[model samples]
Target chain A: MNRLDDDDDRPLSPEEMLRLIEEQQATTVRRLGGDPLLTHTPWGITWLAGFGALYLNYAYDLLSRSTALAVLFALMVLSMATTFFAQRTVSSQVRGEAADRGMMYGLSWMFGFACVVAICVRLSPLLPSEETGLLWSVTSMAIVSALYAAGGALWRVRTMFFLGAWLAALNVAGAIAGPTVHALLISVGAGGVFTAVGVVQWMRRRGGA
Target chain B: MTGPRELDPVIHAQARLRVVATLNTLGEANQITFPGLRELLGMTAGNLSVHLGKLEEAGYVEIVKTHRGRTPTTYVALTRQGRRAFEDYTATIRELLDLG
Candidate 1:
């Protein structure tokens, strides 16, 4: 602990301020590290399941197939909470000023952008009815995921960038990948990729230690 | 004729100052949690609980509790009175600093 950690001492450096901010962004994820998404990898993709499950509901509801939208919504919230948990866990484990204040939150912005797209698609009837709700939901997830990856990349978390890029690629590949495959890619491929990344990162972290 | 000034910890001390600044990062414009305040301040649980208790006593902060599943999360916020006190404190501090 330097003078910066000294409570009774003088002010902190600008670098110190940035470090504090970084740790806070990842607080919850760290506090709740058991989340599936927070796996040992930087790009664990299991988080995409929330969107994949949501997509199934959209497909079902299309035949005017009404099920438990509320339940699904609840699950979505749970998934987000878990994701935040994983993020916070990772942040907490991060040492030094650089790790504490990594640029992870920007990923949520991508989600915001995706949400906007989902809303637009929902209102416009551009996508198939069955795909409508899921479309909106997944689009939003994609946006957020992409941004988070971007943030991870910015923070030099190569795994984060790898995961984010994979999602952006998924969106591009969606047309060819189609819905069922797209969903699987996100849920399985993407998720597996992320988990792998987390594992590898963790290994490296351990090896370094 | 005006009265005597106020006392607000959210506006003072290195610790409370860090707490509010960190909360601002959440951007919800809503409340913060006890664990969150503790994390933001990077203080031990008991130490933070003590500072928060003092702030609450001074009418500078308020705490609300809720549960997510079995875990109880405590939400904290600056009261209107607390915010006013903090604002007043900031102004006085600025004035004092300016005098220096």
Candidate 2:
């Protein structure tokens, strides 16, 4: 630890200052860029509940489209409510520029997702009845996965990249598994994985690490 | 390029420069705890306090001491002046490097 003293007031030249600034920025980013609440327990539970609702909705689609959609809508609303509460809790503990950036990134992702969904809904009438739902789901998942990958690269977070890869692989599995099996896989397998990651992160933070 | 004399002396020292850079990287509105800053810079608490004191005296950074339950916690954030100083410093550096 170099203590700055007025007696030793040696000024850094422009080049030296620039080098020091870059060094400091790199070190700080490595230190503070990660937010533990990113995979919080509340977030994990919300993912599980939300994906479970979607699973049920998709499984029932063959029997009743309208009913399935209604369930899905209810689930979506519930997921959003839970997420809102989760964010509030996490924000109280994690207050920093990183948190602010995460919120901005989340908002952008939601906006992009909404746009993709709207476009898919508009195009669904043109597609064959047998393929419409599957096409929409795959497309949405692929887009989200790609965005996650891009974000991971930008932020240098390996977990985010793995998440993107997982989602993309799930899309492939969905294509082969059919709607019912795919829905089950999403709810029980993927949701469980997300929850487990969140739990681990929560525990680490609680342990003050 | 801004002349060396035009640069703020209060922000010209190496440790203080690093301090300003770290705060600036976090964004102008962000406030970091004293422990947080110390950890970020890998500086001793006494060393960090001295640099922060200099910055505070120059009105470049603001320090707040508050009680969390019974314990006192120190928070540090760059003032508007500090942010501007950093921006100017970076711009000057860029100009110098571009010329070279």
Best-matching candidate per lDDT:
2
TM-score of predicted chain B versus true chain B for each candidate: 0.74, 0.88
- For model 2, residues A1-209, the per-residue Cα lDDT tens digits are 34246533675656877888988886666456444344323434543554455566665544355555565556556655665665554433334565686688768778878887898889889977545766665776677678777778866778767877886787789768776555566556656776786667556545642
Docking class of 1: incorrect
Residue pairs with backbone overlap in model 2: none
Docking class of 2: acceptable
User: Who wins the TM-score comparison?
Assistant: 2
TM-scores of the models, in the given order? Answer: 0.42, 0.52
User: Which residue ranges in model 1 land beyond 4 Å of their true spot?
Assistant: A1-75, A85-118, A121-127, A203-209, B1-100
lDDT of all predictions: 0.53, 0.68
DockQ of each: 0.04, 0.30
Off by over 4 Å in 2: A1-13, A35-169, A172-209, B1-5
- Per-residue lDDT for A13-54 in model 1, tens only? 334434443554455323322333354332333345444564
